[model samples]
Target: MSSDRTLLMRPSPAARESLSALTPILHRVVERIGETNDITTLALEPLEPPSMNFRCGQFNMLSALGVGEIAISMSSAPHERMLRHSIRDVGAVSHALCQSSVGDLVGVRGPFGSDWRVESARGDVDQRDTVVVAGGIGLAPLRGAVEELVRDTQRGGGRIFILVGAREPSQIVFRADLESWKARGAKVSLTVDLATSEWDGRVGLVTTLLADAGFDATNSRAMLCGPEVMMRFTARALIDLGMDPEGILVSLERNMQCGVGWCGHCQLGPLLLCRDGPVVPYAGLVSQLLTQRER
Candidate 1:
């Protein structure tokens, strides 16, 4: 679909205004999925009915009253309404999310962007092989994608290889959850740049570890999210490994001030980063990215 036509799918004005209000939801921190290098995972209970539903790989704009707001992906899938966030404590607002008490207040404003193609994968059988590659905080968004394929009762042909990496062993998000998934027979592989005494897993850049993991990619769908550099590199790897540009889906992050596209900070070429996408197919936006900055 064309870019302008794509933005037409965005929510109406009244909905956007309500999102701007930053409705408070008194959700509790039910579980800490993982915490490393100052990033924390929080689980919340909804105080009111959410106006929007989130899918795996979608995100929300969260804020702290006196501090600021940042874009965070929905760690929880639509079926699992339990809101989860993996916040890196690099700034004041993120730090607040880290230090917040179990029964704290959080301003939840989305369920935004395109969701992982779970329902489609559930119905599609043989071509259902999916691979999810993540780096840094990128693992958070794609977690739901993994959950869907692994937990989908109807999807038998679906197989997932979750390859995740971080700066070091201590900074890896969802460590315990990933471990549990692996224990439950989910095909998950983890890596880190800096090895630690406690670490017995692979040690290398995320892309390097891909050398050890192999998959039949003839008709597979691959989803990746993480730092822009990592996503670019991984996209190339998937292409080299036989995945088509159309089959490779990526989540694109830009400086977003408004959930609606009216704010121009998140613009990527003719596309609105806020409305048209946080997710873009390689076939559509590859050339635009190639013409720009290296990082």
Candidate 2:
């Protein structure tokens, strides 16, 4: 095993052209919700509507030119195109994005991506089952789907359960929304990798939380978004609990350039992650793809 540490820095690639429906977003930070460590929620908006729209779970690559571009998921729905990016100040672009003050100008690109199958879940709710597993900012993708499920009645079949795990309680995203969800009777279970005094929540990995949540794996479909390690383990756990492999949706993150898949930047072996899937069935990934890091 390599002992080298992973470095956090901005990618050097030039920014690609933003889609026709997108534009430079000039807005203000109406609110800032800091959780801990440098992860914070920024409620920023554009002075005007984005030329384009995106499905839930799609992401935009935001850039500050020399600062670099980072893919951030849109936490808001289509109607509220006003963008909300939950940023962790980990690298140059991210740090720049987070350091900006109210009313700063930023560039936004296509709601580029292979969107999560939130649409498929529609009208599928009666006696339907749904499960979401997220780690750290992994929760970003799931948040949109959860909101869709909670509000969209066409999907009246399934009961929704969210199992989220973070490094520590402070690293958790959507803290206020979590309480609001609970108050509104949504089922959410949380855990953490490391404990801090501020944490009174469950202590353990997300897999453990999944095991105890008592989901009917046979009928429930699961969406897992997290680091590769967590997503892999979570998929195995779900299968062991009797969920069908085909029923689980996973987002494979790779370096994405042409979000449309032509550039091949986000290819996963034979599959192009940006086009074929950022969301895909676990069964579809080739064994070699699952086992190796991309060259």
Model 1 is weakest, by summed lDDT over 10 consecutive residues, at 1-10
Segments in model 1 whose C-alpha atoms lie over 4 Å from true places: 1-34, 50-52, 121-126, 290-295
Query: Residue by residue across 97-190, what tens digits does model 2's lDDT show?
Result: 8887665656666667666676664534445577889998888767777777666434464677888899887788888777766665568999
How many residue pairs collide in each prediction?
A: 2, 12
Query: How well does candidate 1 match the true structure in TM-score terms?
Result: 0.84
- How much does each candidate deviate from the true structure in C-alpha RMSD? 7.3, 7.8
Predictions in order: lDDT: 0.71, 0.71
What TM-score, computed on C-alpha atoms, does each candidate reach?
0.84, 0.84
In angstroms, give how far residue 206 of model 1 lies from its true place.
Answer: 1.3
